[model samples]
Target: MSTLALGVIGNCTIAALIDPAAALVWGCFPRLDGDAVFPALLDGGGADAPAQADGRFALTLIDQSQSEQSYLPNTAILRTVLRDSHGGAVEITDFCPRFALFERIYRPPTIVRRVRPLAGRPRLRIQLRPRFDQGRLAPEITRGSNHIRYVGPAQTLRLTTNAPISYVLEERPFLLDRPVDLLLGDDESLEAGIELTARDLFERTHDHWRNWVRSLSIPFEWQEAVIRAAITLKLCQFEETGAIVAALTTSIPEAPDTERTWDYRFCWLRDAYFVIHALNRLGGTRMMEDYLRFIGDVVEDAADGSLRPVYGITREAALDESVVPHLAGYRGMGPVRIGNQAHLQIQNDVYGAVVLASTHAFFDRRMTRPGDGALFEQLERLGARAVALFDQPDAGPWELRGSAAVHTFPAVMCWAACDRLAKIARRLGRDDRAAHWRGAADRLHGIIRERAWNPEIGSFVSTFDGSEMDATLLLLHEVDFLAADDPRFAATVEAVAKTLRNGDFLFRYVAADDFGRPRTAFVICVFWYIDALAALGRRQEARDLFETVLAHRTPLGLLSEDIDPRSGELWGNFPQTYSMVGLINCAMRLSHPWEEAF
Candidate 1:
């Protein structure tokens, strides 16, 4: 059966998910949101093998008995070792070439595979099958001297290989006496010898990743875990547009047999803010700088200063939801969605998200271009909208479809918008504007404190005057809505921990929603809870829970959106950016300071 244990390899431009057996199961071509040229991940769930589907690239070892997979240290390069029963083995190295070329970052939508025979005469069969339009269109295959082109309606892909094209085209098993290099990318011709080009790219790409990882200010403790999460989060960014996707592949159910799937290939302002904030903590300012460009475009495009919850990778505002019937969902879950309707919803939190993310650029002297008065004035427009709708709720951060409430989280986020504007104004020496925003922030703060608190429950509820707790309530301290030492804030934290704790995990909420109630734990909630615990001076408890959460990661040290509390199985989208952001945040908070450790 297919699982989220798959490994991901990509440049910022594109990524592919490879299963334990070294099969290319899921990938989008040209760009991250383009057609799924390799869609075996969503073809059928619980199948004996992905071979039952057609959209995959497999390097199958005859009489294969054991396999092992791992990332080349501190890099996105994936290494898989497969061994047959008769001591025959082959090593497969996979990566999308990303490095410096021609005085610029060179990241193409190409996947490079280098296979080397490691043991006694290994026999291998190479199958490269790519589909288009969600598996509804089969491309016209044409063979050249050394390359095969798969021509589709919108785009064409070329597979250039040093191996015999006849063997690859015929799917014939052949002896792997030497290393084989295959490059699947654009329809362009190779510039140099196949071996020389592949070798140069491999060396440069490896050096690029190592240099990039060396630049990160990762925590000393759990270095491996942090690096992996950081790399995965970086992979989720669409470099061309500077938009960070919520995940790679979508429509993976949050739990079994639930139609709770939603497309996450687009950018959610809320998720993007958290992603940038986490990366900033690691000294990854380049990502933040790139994302600011995307956010600036989003702000400029919002004529009314009202932002949507999500947008397309290329800044397309209209993300109409539609189902793809041609493809089965993750685990055979049906109704694979193409776009997100959340783009059309009124998500008030987005106002604050934009300001919070932009705030970093204004104060950091390290920024190449700091936020100036014009940007502050532009953000004030969003602040106006935040003030107008802070309490009048639409879909909250959870993006509930059937219900809209005066959710406390969005209300607090709106408060943050006003609060940040005040700080930014002070930084710009605009005393009058600062005073005005500070007053507005104070008024909203008073209102939230009075209305969001359920005195009987001793907690700030999910909604105003509602007696329910959700995991987001734990963010009161993290968001600076309340002080950690405040008795009310501590009480709210305890209330949420008591109300939402499942077996070893924390549920987002237990209340019934549009899809009955969520059965599994939202993975990021556990990290939020850990951060809250640490802020409350329960460091030991926080560290223990942080370790527990780390243990639940897939073998590749990756996480999905949700997890079964009872079984610890991952669910939802692959390589969820929210989950990775949480892991990075919690590791930074819980790790012992280097000065103390040494």
Candidate 2:
């Protein structure tokens, strides 16, 4: 129970990861990329010690018997119900309150928990441990009449509650005749009665999310799953700045002892494009619009008209990679790395993501900064960069550091950039510019057809002059670089299926990466393969595989970034935006029509 399972709760300003028992194992303060105050998810990894207590905020129920978890119907709120053998039950509701307020989005840096006695009186203890600088230090706690303020170097946190402060502080069980409301924030005081304020906040939070879910264009089939995935993706967004992070926690390994852990708490240009695409399909346009502004800021500030693969939430350019020396890694795996070095890699695919993501602004009338002649000029610079780097060797989409190649994935993205820019040019009546970009696209298309294709292997490879294959090549037909019906595409699909596909999952690549060969399957790649299968008219098989992957999601109907292929166990960062986007996209593409269901 010490290991952090995949239940997550957030309100866009911040998020927390927990287990089924509702232990706060992993989360940051202030924002997604901030310091990891709860490092137990990493430090306590697979430790089976019954007394797990360090670096966690959890309800320590005394005389606990049975526990289970679920979400508050169509909301991001998490409910963990614990029952004692003596016929007493308690329900713990965890969420970060957010709703429309002051004619704007009200997403505060807060985490809310409400404990209620469901049946008879229940006894529980609250274990609250606040840390600083990724577990390198602890914050000083100063007590107040109704609250305790934990002042850290970076920020301050307040826990205001109705529960006895001494009981909570000493980790002693107390009878819960009624509900105890707790609010963790720094902005304001809850001078009003705790129960009254908490009840009102929970109601508003519930109403806000249920209404937001109502606005989604979810497929009729798998509606519940799609709704949950959509909520998780929205939670991953930093609404204040409109930046969508890849994942919440950092240094959760992709595979056991593989050294594949990464800090996914920052936004990546490539990942955002797919996120925008998935949300667009589900009719979640507000998120797309907010994210566009985030991307626009990055694009507008591009150094020398070139874009990097990743950027910080506040659009910070420099993210130096290092390890937190004090904390043990997730599952006792040491050397928990902080920050990311991929910021320095040459990922040419980002140029395409920039143009593709911005293309919506031109046509979507609802955009705040709708595309204009000036914006098109700004985007053209990115297109030119894509064309220039189309055939150059850089890090592939997987961010491989040990080697470089003229990867097929980035090459096709470069083609997509030219293709999209040409269409945009034509839309704006710039016929000359249209001709130039299209000509570039046509030339690159020819080059990819020639070099990326392996005549001997009877399929397209991961890179030009390479027989090696990676999961990203599954997207060849997705970008329209090749038609699904094209025999070449079919052969490429079969080739990747033979080499990278293992059972229902697909490996990113079997070739040894920086940490040696990957031992787990990336869930999103399987989604891409399923989409490809559906496109190729293998609908039934695709649907079956899709179901198997769906069953692999965490109990709370969410997914992490990676999964153990050998044991079918979930791993890596929590509530991965990429994985959730895959669920939404696949369900939309493969589900039976609403009319058919009826």
Candidate 3:
């Protein structure tokens, strides 16, 4: 299209429409760890190398008269309609290759793009830009009459056209462009003038997406929204490793004009349970089983059973956060960051997430019967560590900037670990260990009630000795640590709403008490509020807030980590999985009220 519209349908795939022209991709790789062939996203339409180091390309779509776009039912495939001033129209479809297993695993993914003249005769222009190795390494381009190959150290990008389009290579920005004919007549004669056809690839990719979608078992009334979210979650998954990343892009700010920007390209164990829960609820368990296997392998690889909060999609743990000074951040939020420093921090809550996810897999009706002794030992080890560190100060769930404390949320999760372990032990006939787990759980519950609770404020504080209320504690009710009818639980929810709710949304915590500049509302916290509202029997209010949160989604139904209420713009990383998890969980809770057993 003449105008460029960039948005995401799934958390993993990014699609753009250039009106009356061609569509371009933003940030997506064959695998989670693969390089970005389209580095122009960070450079702002400038020349950059392909995700591999060998080839480089940039794109410019011009001479567009008018255009429109839409998705294909519940699938991620995108269709664009273009119109020229001279009464001509063309249709184009764009998607990444996802058909065969071998193709899915291979590097340098193929972009299966197809174009057809729908109404009248409209001339089309084609441009190909491939930058390798984040646009830093140059590739050797081998050009033939109709085929082109950009070879890098580890991968090769091949482009072939059936149309007679002249191709030339430019050095300064590293781009290629050519004009092609779009002939339209009777259906029989139209094929004679067409330059190139990718109908085979298009059919294969469409069938692939359709078949995968058919496997989903979504019974909710909001089936379209649920399917969109489910597809996004699947796209965010690294197919080879079964690890799902938090988001697609990096350096999108959480707050304007602050150093809060961080990369969300890696996997977080904290999301493991939520991811599995979402998939299990939606009637898809294959991906969950693969993810659990990945988790088991990670546990076995670790010298100790203890795990890091985050890691690469491939299970690599060494992620060093650094700034790329050369490129300006999104909307000039300076110092684009790659990798995450939070990887090194010790977040004890992850242990609970892992235990809960594995246990869910074991108990879920769809999953294969799990090994009792192995899972029990894993839980016992994590429980033992929690008991030993119950009183220690460590980074809280938010990964705060200062020293750690006995964070209320982690303490409650520690209680969950002990509690779930006891249940599992009893089920497996480990009476001795079950007794020990129950005793430890009782002690942890007492600690949470005595140290974390603040009767003076009538709610639990953020930390053991602090007076500030945390929105994270609202999760205590969802986790079953406190019943919704408990007066103390209701008081804590009220305190959090009074303190953290900004308009209809909620902040992770009170910003005025923190060091960073005040930011927009966290999307996940708002969903938490929805869950709290439903649990409290405020179903209508919960649905209203859920719809309001949905209104913040981008034009293509993608969500970021945060939303700027004042500007109505998406902030933080795009297509955040945690945000989607929050959405799907709230939707499920609203649909099936009795599923809140946690």
Candidate 4:
């Protein structure tokens, strides 16, 4: 019931993270950026153990012995089949319905749970525990004929169901004779029969997602993984404003007692850029197009030449970091934080991220808002910021806390900004601006080549004039900063492969920063290394490593933000979009051609 390997179901507006055994352990209300109404996953009795099943909403099969779970292929709908020793079984189908209604997508902040007896007689107990105000207050409940209303300080939640209301209120076991539907969301009366309405919604939602997945230009190999990752990534996007959250849960420590737990519920421009870019490869342009609005608003709203690394999903600019003392952290690690502080720090990489994301809007003919002169002018300011800070000391992409250094990764991203700007300008027929940005790119590239390369170490170091190597350099060829086989880039990759590599994973960096040497691997960095390996013509080795990494994924075929280097156990936040993007991108890079599949 407390598995970290959980399935996520959402409707672009709201999301719920359910354990393998059909328990809703973690989920926010209203939106992805909202407060956690269920934070049991953050307090699992002290040690690094799976959460105790008490604080979550669960359907316990009284006669059940074992269970099996899977998603309805190509959709976010989850199916958990609970089987008892005496041949009694029931199937629980969970999802947040999202499909086209009247004229627009009807993605409400709602969750639909449908339970049906599959074989024999199945008895089940229902437990619904919902806390409010960031797990600080437990709401009082009031039940009517069939719906239950839970009213808290600031919000109210209503659950309309076909199941006996008294059983839900008293947590009593009931016999399963027919189907029952549990719909939780806005306080509204059901229009049709509960079970029938839920089934219709499920069918429509399934068709919507399946049709969407079919539109993707997926790679030939690992089609299923790619599709799931793609779907999860899409669900993470807040459709209201086109913002993408990094992950579902927050304050899940990067390592045991490392104090590296962070709030990833907000939108990080850098992370969203990577997500949009990855989805773009699959011909998923709608996400990109929607995100373009977010980017434009961010750029336009900038009072000065600076933009935040992260922001509130609903366009709230400021997010001051703080902890929730009431709810113990994940695994009972204290200091469950609410907001992120990286917003106030300097991160030059966002300039390039914005520019990279903006490129699609300008050049892609299918886009609604193709880049025009005005948009380009607004972006020019971002390009100028990148040019100014390429060599300045600030927080790098890794967001080290203690000190700021002229990290090579963000510097190269700056180069990418100007370089991409020049390309966009050329496409727009602005020869003068193109030449200007091209000159700036060349200048930054020259600086990086001279300052970042350490001949003594025979590699491109993480920081300028420093010797420590990190996995970020694995992206050298990815950004076109260096060619795949460039001797210097090749040697840098080899050096990282020797130093940062750990079994099938790669530590983001080896050196101690603010805290100390990282105890685990940043999972995405390993996929970056895989890309580096494949680029180096180490196809067989890359494939071997890719398979090894895939084996480490949780049973649900998903990964967390961080992985214990020694145990290969998922460590950080659950259902990390970064890790999922890695899965899709690596699968695209390493999988065999569709032509050969026949």
Candidate 5:
């Protein structure tokens, strides 16, 4: 008896039965970076359309019973477990080409599909459909008995079959049971096949991942979470320019009915600190070095000193947000956007993050000669910008709406900027600038302690005059603004723990005037708790809390920006890099206690 299971959501999904005899992947394209060929995942009509309408492809696996899915340890190569009811099993591995390192690179995109059946004899069925321009435009189809070519407005898609399987153009979903192999690309023919066993492929994939993971020097306790977080971090890095995106998808709401959806597909300067810290802990200094190089390139390429807070994956500073009204958002969030308009905002804190991250790189011995010089120049220019805007009001760390106010966190970050620059300048023999930066940092710290800190609340305020507590203040110890053991620090931590801690997770801030109950715990705040716990000599508690957060990771080992404490469903964008970065930082903090390391 054959039971068919079809899963359709967004522009990417897989459908198969429990036994995994045959599986179908729809909406996948030639490459991970390319647009979807089967837009059905985004629209219901595309899923019902014939594969030959344009150049869309459906992959089918046959002759298997049970199926499971996982990643190759620390890599993005997805491994699917296929087994027969009797006991035979196989594993299929899939990964898109990285940047253009492969022998054949498609201009648009191409997806690589490798199938192997283990134990018992498993037959596979494959289908290819290459849709163009979000499946809105049809392509000119050139059909052959065993091959097909689809030429579109800007790209060409070709599919060739190896096994005998009937190619039909029906208007509804159908099943293909026979062995069929096909390739989809512009001018290239991807090798497709149905192997009797996936043993060799599994072994190779396993070894590749194992070797890559072994390159990391993570401690034992945080190994699993670190590895997973590291892998997630790698997935967000655009290989072409080494720029890491904040998230993969856009329009996933931070809160239901709050209209908090924002595109996170661009690189953020704010992420620099967490990325560097995490990579440093993982002993993966290469990424930090690459980031420094990218920063230098952007500075050199830019016509002026005006820097953007975010940039495209290819290091392009231009990012204009536009909604795709044609398709509905995930779970009907509405206004599904592709690009981010946040780049247009002048976020002063980004300067501090960049300076702090560069300082981390320098101290970690990751910055090379010319890059060091470039970093110095960058710090100089950023210092000038910070000083010029130190008293001005602009978008703060939260990037809030309504008014651009003098945010406490951004001011603190500006302090970090000056502080890091002071140290670096001193090291580089620029004593005069170093002294100026140090004075600036000292004055900013004094101002924060005076104006931002609320004596009644005993914790740092969210804004300069706001009495509310912000989780971003939890980084006081992280940025060395205050000693972890300082009485004020202890008081602030206790205050947040009492007011903001919702079970193990923490809220971003507490609004004294809010009407509704406090929202779900922010995942990043939970990580901040772990950091604070570690800093406050609560090692065991920090470790336990860290594990508790890990338990919230989705079945596929992915993390969203937030999670419903009641239902435990993921909220916000899937696979958030910030969440992963927090995971990595907490792990490092737990593994290496501050007292001993600092």
Candidate 6:
């Protein structure tokens, strides 16, 4: 059976997910949100469907017996070792080249694969299938002596390789007598020899990642985990536009065989705020800077000073949700989706999320272009929107399709927006605006305190005057909505723990919505709970739960959006940015100080 036990390789512009057997199962070309050239991750179909999907590039070791996979330390390069039953073995290295060149970063939308013989002459079979139009059509293929081009309607992919073209084209098994190099990218010819070019790119890319990792201020204890999570988050960023995708792929369901699937290839302000916050903790402000640029464009384009919950990577506003009927979903599940309907949602929290994400610009001296009075003026408009919509009914953080509520989380986020704006105004010496935003924040806080608290339940609920609790409530202290020592905050934490906690995991909510009750635990909520625990001085409890959450990560120390509470099986999109951000945040929060450890 297929699983999300995969490793990711990317250059911040394009990304691919490879399975343990060194199969390139998922990748988008030309850009991160572009057509998936290799879409086998979502092409598993019914009994009548072909046994092997026609959207992947698979390398099989003949009579394979065992395989192992790992990443090079402090880098995104993945290495897989496969050994056959008859003592033949091979090692496969996969990565996308990203390095400094010509005074700027050179990150191409390319994937490089190096397969070398390890022990005996390993027989290998290559299955290279490239699909287009959301897996509805195959690309037109043309071959040259040393390269093959897969031409699609929107983009063309060229593969330059020194491997036997005949064996590769015929999908025949062949002896791995010597090392082979394959470069798959834009339809461009290489100026240097394939072997030398691949080698140089590999060395430079390796050094680039190592240097980047060295610059992070990772926690002393969980340094490896933090570094991997940081790199995964960085990969989700579309560096060209500074838009950070919530995840790389779309339509991977949160649960099996459900309509809960949605595309995560676009940027969500709420999710991006969390990602920026986590990366900021690790001293990676470049992503935040790029994202602010994306935000500036969106703000300038919004004539009415209104912002959508999500936007396309290039700041395109219309994201009409569609179904790709031709491609079966993961594990034979159906209804693979392309665009996200959440772009049309009234996720009111986004106003505060944008403000929260931008607050760093005003205070951090490291920013090249610090937030100025002009930027503050633009953000105040978002604060006004937050004030107007804070208590209104709309889709909550979970993005319910059929129901709307005046969610407490969004209301609190609105308060945070105003509160942060007040601080920003003070930083700019705009006393009048500071006082105005301060009053606005105080009034909203009082309203939330009065209406959102359920006296009968002895805790704050998901919505105003509601009686249910959700995992997002656990963020009260983290967002400064409530103090950790406050009795109300403690009670709310207890309420969330009692209502949503399942075994060792925490569900986003227990209430059923449009499809049905959610069957898997939202991974980030558990991390939020751990943070709350640490803040409440339950260090031992927080550390124990943190370790349990770490155990659910894949072999490469990556996580997805959701996981089965009972089985610990990962579901949802692979290498979810939200889940990885949660990992880094929790690690930083829970790790002992380096001085104390020393």
Each model's Cα RMSD: 1.0, 1.5, 6.1, 1.8, 5.7, 1.5
Give lDDT tens digits, candidate 6, residues 206-276.
99999999888899888989999999989999999899999999888899988888889999988757877
TM-scores, all models, native as reference = 0.99, 0.98, 0.87, 0.97, 0.83, 0.98
Give the per-residue lDDT digits (tens) of candidate 2, residues 1-598: 3443557999998898877766788778888788788777788453342444567788867777888999999999999998988898999999998999999978888888999899876788888887888877888888877788888887888999989998877777899897888898774688688788888888999999999999999897889899999999999999989999999888888877667778889999998668878978888888999999899889889746798889999998888899887777877765688889999999999988888888888777766678878888888889889988989999999998988989999999999999989989998999999999999999999999999999999999999989999888888888888888999989989999999988778999999878777888898999999999999999999999899998988788888888877788877777788999999999999999989987
Instruction: Indicate which candidate wins on lDDT.
Output: 1
Native-to-model Cα distance after best TM-score fit, residue 411 in candidate 1, in Å? 0.4
User: By lDDT, highest first, what's the ranking?
Assistant: 1, 6, 4, 2, 3, 5
lDDT tens digits, residue span 1-598, model 4? 2346777889999898887667887888888978688777886542123333344778878856888999998999999999988888999999999989998899988999999999988898888878889888888999999899988887888999989999999889999998898999988888898877898999999999999999998988788888988998898889989988888878888888778889988888887567777877888888878878887898999857688888888767788889898877776766788889988888888888888888888778988778999889988999999999999998898998788999999999989999999999999999999999999999999999999999998999999999999888998899899998699989999899899988778899888888888999999998998888899999999889888898888876888899987877788887898999998889888988889989
For model 1, state the Cα shift of residue 399 in Å.
0.6
Clashes of 5: 24
Q: Tens digits of per-residue lDDT for model 1 on 446-522?
A: 99999999988888999998998899999988878999999988898889889899977999999999999889999
- Distance from true location, Cα of 233 in model 1, Å: 0.8
lDDT of 6 at 382: 92
Error of 1 at 355 (Å): 0.6
Model 3 agreement with the true structure over 9-45: per-residue lDDT tens digits: 2323332222223435444444554566554555533
Please write out the lDDT profile of model 5 over residues 365-451, one tens digit for every residue: 544533355568767787777766665687667665445767777787888888988998887788997898999989888987888
User: How big is the positional error of residue 587 in model 5, measured in Å on the Cα after superposition?
Assistant: 1.1
Candidate 1 weakest lDDT stretch, 10 residues: 44-53
As for TM-score, the candidate ahead, 3 or 5, is 3
Residue 143 Cα positional deviation in candidate 2, in Å, after optimal superposition: 1.4
The better-scoring model by lDDT among 4 and 6 is: 6
| Candidates sorted by TM-score, best first | 1, 6, 2, 4, 3, 5
TM-score-best of 1 and 2: 1
What is model 3's C-alpha RMSD?
6.1
> What's the lDDT for residue 481 in model 5?
88
